[model samples]
Target: MNIENYYNIDAQGQIVSFTREQASSFAKGIAGDFNPIHDEDHRRFCVPGDLLFSVFLAHYGVSQRMKFEFSGMVVDSTQLIFPAQLSSHMSLSDANEKNYMDIEVSGDNSKEAEFISMLSEKYVQFSSKTFPHILVPLMEQEKVMINPSRPLVIYKSMEITLDKLSGKQIELSLKEASLTNKGKKGEVRLEFAILSAGEEIGHGAKNLLLSGLREYDASQLDDVIATYTQRKSEFLAVA
Candidate 1:
């Protein structure tokens, strides 16, 4: 995983900017995310959140336990800086110090490039599948669906804890999923396991929010999923 291919950084190691194409490409090609919000032509185009996670790992490497909370969405050409040292809590922010992600990390950290790269690719692959593959079914089970006309699925936060830190090939599988609804707002929690050589090595949880929820309308929701799938297929066909 060549993380530098996804974002631009200066000689001093400060992330300089991301073009819309870079963001869109990273979302589709690297993370397998086809969210329209990340599309280059979208009205509210923003860099894929997973790209930031990858950059952090690319710079600071992986930790035994880590958590990330997204506070704001990033647009093109925004400058970002990572701390030179890790702390119990850290912020990934811009030149103005406007924070986008709040990070909490503890336990020993590994700066091994190979391990970090593999873990990043594996983790993003799992995170990117939240839409139709995981969240749709969970929504159906909860008897709710996000608004089709103005669907808003937010990347709220994610965390992981590892029992060990060495693996060449990493894999992930969902172990549990649940959703808690509060009127039109809801939180979807996905718990997954990290597997190496077919054995559990770590566990993680990704939490997302869905706004403008409504009664489950199978046909309408299916249309949304279909649209997303179609976009992915079309992109691949052209790529």
Candidate 2:
């Protein structure tokens, strides 16, 4: 797949505009993210955070140690511009300069096209599976659930530190996952390790914010999972 097409970046490698169609396609096609908020017709539709991360990597390249912090949501047809030049730190903003995400890079960096693409694909596939596979179990264990009506889960931030990176393919495995709740809001930390040839090469953590949370009901949670699974199956079958 031509990753650039998913983000609607131009020939100059700048994201002039993003649309709901593009965001929806990227969420389902690239990340397997079936969240309703990513739906084109959803009232509260927002671009997938993973899509933004993929665009950043496609433009700025990947680094040995990197940090990404999300500040605002990108709505449909929002006009955005990638930094003209990359620095150790950069912020993605709109035409009016409203910041959406802050990115920081340190340590070794790689500009190899193949390596960046491989890493991007591997990491995103891993990150996208956080929902039912990881978050569901975690939420069940914590006895809390995101509000069944709204179900707002925000991608907060992520950080990665690597000893070294090589090879054409990488595999990610969860090292640890924890959820902390304070009243109605909760924070989830998913710690993961990157491996190649069955040897660890790097580690990272993805943080998510869960809002409007309430006490979990076993039947309600089961229903949610069932819905999610059916949606995923339908998507896969269509693909």
Candidate 3:
């Protein structure tokens, strides 16, 4: 996926803005995420959080170990302002310093486009499947589910640990998908392994925060899944 098509950067090398179309297209084209909130014409037209994660890695270089904590969502209209460099701990914010994400990095780094592209594509394809392929089973096992009308699943954090940053083409496989909840809040952790040429190279976890949880309702969830699948089908058919 050519992530450069998803956002704009000024001549000064700072990311400037994301158009609704750009964000929506990236969500579908690369991440295979058809969430309506990412629809160009949706009322809540926000850029996919995974897009931010991808842009950060593309620009700053991927480290052997990294963690990203998202604090807020990014609307298409928000012009992002970034730090001059990627330090040990960096917070990405808007012009008014409205922090949206915090990043922490350590270990060796690679700026090679081939490796970065492979990693970005592999990681996002896995992360984007959290909805049904991964989350549904976890929710069923836990006997808890998010609100069907206002499903608010937040990208709390994601971390990756790589044994080394060298790989011709990357592969990511889900090692486990688990959920731990208390009261109305739940955290879903999707642990995955990174491999190259069928050999394990590293691992990572994508953490999601689900709020307004309640006892799982099979009927309600089935309806929700039907809606999601219908939207995805319609979008793809048109595209």
TM-score between model 1 and native: 0.97
Ranking by TM-score: 1, 3, 2
**Best candidate, TM-score-wise?**
1
State the displacement of the C-alpha of residue 83, model 2, in Å, after optimal TM-score superposition.
Answer: 1.6
For candidate 2, lDDT tens digit of each residue in 67-169? 9999999997677888788789888888789999999998777676776777777788899899889998889899999876677888999998888756645
TM-score of 2: 0.94
Give the local distance difference test score of model 3: 0.88
Candidate order, lDDT descending: 1, 3, 2
Q: Alpha carbon lDDT of residue 108, candidate 1?
A: 91
Better of 1 and 3 by TM-score: 1
Model 3 Cα lDDT, one tens digit per residue, 99-161: 999999999888988888889988888888888888888889889999999988888999999
TM-score of each: 0.97, 0.94, 0.96
- Mark the regions of model 2 whose C-alpha exceeds 4 Å error after superposition: none
Off by over 4 Å in 1: none
lDDT score, candidate 1, position 52 = 87
lDDT of 2 at 229: 82
Number of backbone-clashing residue pairs for each candidate, in the order shown:
0, 0, 0
Candidate 3 runs further than 4 Å off = none
